[model samples]
Target: VSHEFKTPINAIEGYTMLLQGEELSPDQEEYVEKILFNTQRLSGLVGNILLLSKLENQNIPMKKTEYRLDEQIRQAFLSLETKWTEKEIGFQVELEEVKYTANEGLFMHIWINLLDNAIKFSPSKGTITMFLKQEQDSVKFILEDEGPGIEDDVKSRIFDKFYQVDGSHKAEGNGLGLALVKRIVDSAGGTIKAENREYGGCRFVIELPKQKDEII
Candidate 1:
């Protein structure tokens, strides 16, 4: 199914890219830009669906290794600079130097999805803060975003498959990101939770056990 849909989607995206390079009226350009955006979104959705399916079937193998946690987070944030910059979002990073043994590729999905959500729901010019603290035997990773906090009713199922707070299908995501994140974290023996901040917005906290021997 993924291959079948992605074939045509890729063709559409290619054509859109070509169209974008051509000269057009302001209205025509606007329409083309929307098409380009939706096409790229569809491609992403297809890829996520394929990945989640593999994860559910346990077909993806885990390659756990010791890696610098702070560096990983920094790389993820840098990768999404374009997204946050486009929305005028500011970031406050307070990452402590730490190392952990985990599946680096799978672990990256957690940071990417959480950071993506922070930027997605946050209002323009809002602030997102990330703090990494080393506990006695675990690491506490906290991400706070200045967005509309989750409702009491939806908090329980926020990580469930295909569960989107905005059920109108207007949002960019197909709702599999958080589900994937939860699964990956669980596989790594980590705990993740979401909470509404007292002051405003929402916070996602993840605690992962630290390995005794740290690999440089």
Candidate 2:
């Protein structure tokens, strides 16, 4: 089902990219960008929907692998170079060496989705900070962004599927990102929460069981 949707969306995005490279008036260029953006969004939405259904139905296996946690987070950050660089965003990453046994591919999505969310809401020339440490038998990860913090009322529902932050121009996403994050965390026998940072913006914390512990 996702492939059926993504095939056409990919073609539209490819054509839109070609249009972007062509000479055009400012207005035409803006229109091309809009087309490309929407097409890409549609592609992501399709994949997220499929992933959500798979997780919800327990169709995925409980396979686990031992991997370097810090490296995984760093790679996720590098993968989004263009997105952060476009906004002149700087990262202060402080990760400790830690290894954990888990489904590597599944956990990768958590970092990527969270980083993408942080970058999307970050201000121009802002700084994003990431911290990772082993707490007793578990690994703790934190990501802080410099953007508008969630409102008190809407904060509780941020992880609800299709729930976007209300009354903000920056709340334009399809809102599946955090919901997917929550589902993935549950599958890993972990807990994730969000809070408004005292300084500004939002902070996300994810705590996972020790490598020796049993996984769901």
Per-model TM against the reference:
0.90, 0.86
Query: Which lDDT tens digits does candidate 2 get at residues 58-140?
Result: 99897988788899999999999999999999989899988788888889989999999899889999999999998876789
Q: For each candidate, what is the lDDT?
A: 0.90, 0.89
Please provide, for model 1 over 23-138, each residue's C-alpha lDDT reduced to its tens digit, 9 standing for 90 to 100.
89999999999999999989988988888888889888887788888999999999999999999999899999887888899899999999999999899999999999898878
Candidate 1: RMSD over Cα atoms? 2.0
Error of 2 at 45 (Å): 0.4
- Candidate 1 Cα deviation (angstroms), residue 85: 2.8
Q: Which candidate is the best by TM-score?
A: 1
How many clashes in each structure?
A: 0, 0
Highest lDDT: give the candidate number.
1
* Candidate 1: segments with Cα more than 4 A from true spot: none
